[model samples]
Target: MAQECRIPHTVLCPARTPTCQTSPYLEAIRRQLAVRTRRLNDTGALTPGPPTASGQSDDPDTHDGPARPVVQLLLCRYLAEHAVEHLRCVAQTRHRHRCPHPIRALTGPAGTWRLLPTGPRRGQLALPDVLMAIYDLGHLPYRGQLRWRAQRCPQHDAAPGAADLALAEWQPFDPLLHAAHIRTRLPHPEARRPGSR
Candidate 1:
């Protein structure tokens, strides 16, 4: 039987879940974005866009925008839906076996987002920056570039001969050939009231 999805607002079974095999990593990214969005909003660092027809402010957390958090979330979703295999360690052991470890940091959000000091005076303010800028950067890398950079896990990263043992054949990823998972739309804010199913 397929596994149950624990992701909020999602109802798909494992077979139909796009991130079923990689939900942990994707969830971490999502949580980071949500937290950052909240922080920025609270601090007034991010200006709310014009109100929608329903008079609700456009929430950066759920809407696509030029903001860093939204862009990062979108990038992560694209990666999760298309190049998920790249999210795993690609290093080859001396025995010609692929590393079993995942490429994502095991320490969750803190491991991905680190505190960084940045301001006009260089010490006036501290902000969180993505550890590797992989998912946080606004620009997406060229095709296969991320996979090449994330080829090894922390343990096998510097292992001698690891690169030499890499598999020779590599298949290109084609999103069209894969089954796309259905994305659950977030309900209207009013529908989230108590006793509202």
Candidate 2:
């Protein structure tokens, strides 16, 4: 039997009733992008999650996917996202119930993740500078009132100066977004504090 999934702040919100609030296609896209771009080895193999047609090794432990520091950072970010996204947001238990906002933090450390202005204007401070500034480290990606998106996700479609590549073409590369994660993890002064307590 399928177990029931509980979501927080959404108990009052109906499930499977249909709403722009949730779109399966968007979720699918998000997940697909996450898989193709977020999960991979430095050599660009499908090691973090499963093997692709590319002949990379199938792996469940993300940490073992990459050896380079940058690769390690990228893998950690993806692993954290996978962990948070799968959490039970609908649980009634105070300790267990949580939204997805801290996810941003988990995506990377502080400042590593930022909000860009969005509106009809060329450039305006339409959005707040810092969001969900709270939450403990590793407990990042707390669901906020808003969601983060790129020009498109999967970079193959949305990132600038990036080309859209098919799964076959992507057989050996991860997302540039993962680069941001890598850059953030460096011991540089620029590294943002991990977005958690």
Candidate 3:
């Protein structure tokens, strides 16, 4: 028989707990860790959200375009506290026979990187001081701020690969490049080429 899950009022996720994919507690925390990327997208702080095509490069570094106004918010202590709160709630709902949701106990030293934020912006920095302050706390584990750059993704020719299979690599969505590719491939554009005209 399995032992009863006697979770505490607060689930103590230690610093050493493995990442979300490996640790059950961290996994639960991951589910709750919504970075609010959509909010950033809506404000034009980022080019756009995901759902990239398989053949197209998703790497932000490959894009060669004017930079957009962007900001990054590093969640430090806030992340840990949030995880604790979430675990506490899950613990409260644990079953008598066994926890319906198993929370792997935190062990070892704390990890440095719980979460890292990265995205592009459309224009100048316009965040209010109060809101920035919350993210800029001294005690926080991670640090970030709005930064400007010309190209979100550096342009590069993709190496030939299995055309039918998606590459096993991270890619940044470059809407500009995607649109340009589509524009070039259109049959109407080919018919109006300089030689034909």
Candidate 4:
């Protein structure tokens, strides 16, 4: 019998999901694009079009099937929504639990991942500016597992110390390090002050 997954959060988070297998169509496109990119590099040519697709599509949105990035974005949105629906709110504890506001995807520059206002009111600010997952683990040359971080849930801003004190308890995932943890680890004035006693 399969072991019951006691912690659904670990298996369900976008970071824990299995790496996507490349589809044959996309692989073919990738190879074609690679060759074209190399050819263009050799000839030093510049044009305004999808640099990644060789006539496969003038626009990635009109392709035969949704591209990998598009699919990944949809998956991220689904997971974010699911987390807000099923998982406990970041502010929840054994004694106190507060329902979380819905999670919303924000758009910004390339590789931007932000969770902002959850309500459905598209305006100049509500639209997504980028396409990426909320989390990304980078492999730096010397750094073991450190990487850039994404925006936190806006609700955390209300509590005076919630941002700092509630970090370790924010999410169930072990590898998902919060910004507060980083700040806490750095030297603080209180720690360096000389004892007056």
Q: lDDT ranking from best to worst?
A: 1, 4, 2, 3
- Residues 1-197, model 3: lDDT tens digits: 99896643234333234333345764565344334443443343444224277744343322221112111123221211112102221211112221122121133122121112222225534422211101112221331111001101111111112121212111233233322211111112221213221
Q: How high is the CA lDDT of each candidate model?
A: 0.37, 0.28, 0.24, 0.28
- Per-residue lDDT of model 2, residues 1-197, tens digit only: 99996644332222223344656765665556555553332223422334568755443312321222221121122212332223222212223432223223344343232211111223433432211111123322432211221111222222244432211111112233333223211121222344422
Off by over 4 Å in 1: 1-86, 108-134, 137-148, 164-197
Candidate 1 residues 1-197, lDDT tens each?
Answer: 99885654332322134443555777566567677776655443555556799975554333222112111322332223222223457677667777776544343221112121111222333433322111232232432334334444556655545663444222322223311221112222332223222
TM-score of 3: 0.15
Index of the highest-lDDT prediction: 1
**TM-score to true structure, per model:** 0.27, 0.16, 0.15, 0.20
TM-score pick, better of 2 and 3: 2
Winner of 2 and 4 under TM-score: 4
Give the per-residue Cα lDDT of candidate 2 at 76: 26
**Residue 23 error for model 1, in Å?**
42
lDDT of 2 at 80: 28
What TM-score number comes out for model 2? 0.16
Native-to-model Cα distance after best TM-score fit, residue 119 in candidate 4, in Å = 36
Worst 10 residues of 1 by lDDT: 110-119
- Give per-residue CA lDDT, model 4, range 17-64, as digits (tens): 424565566456556766776554333252224435465534332221
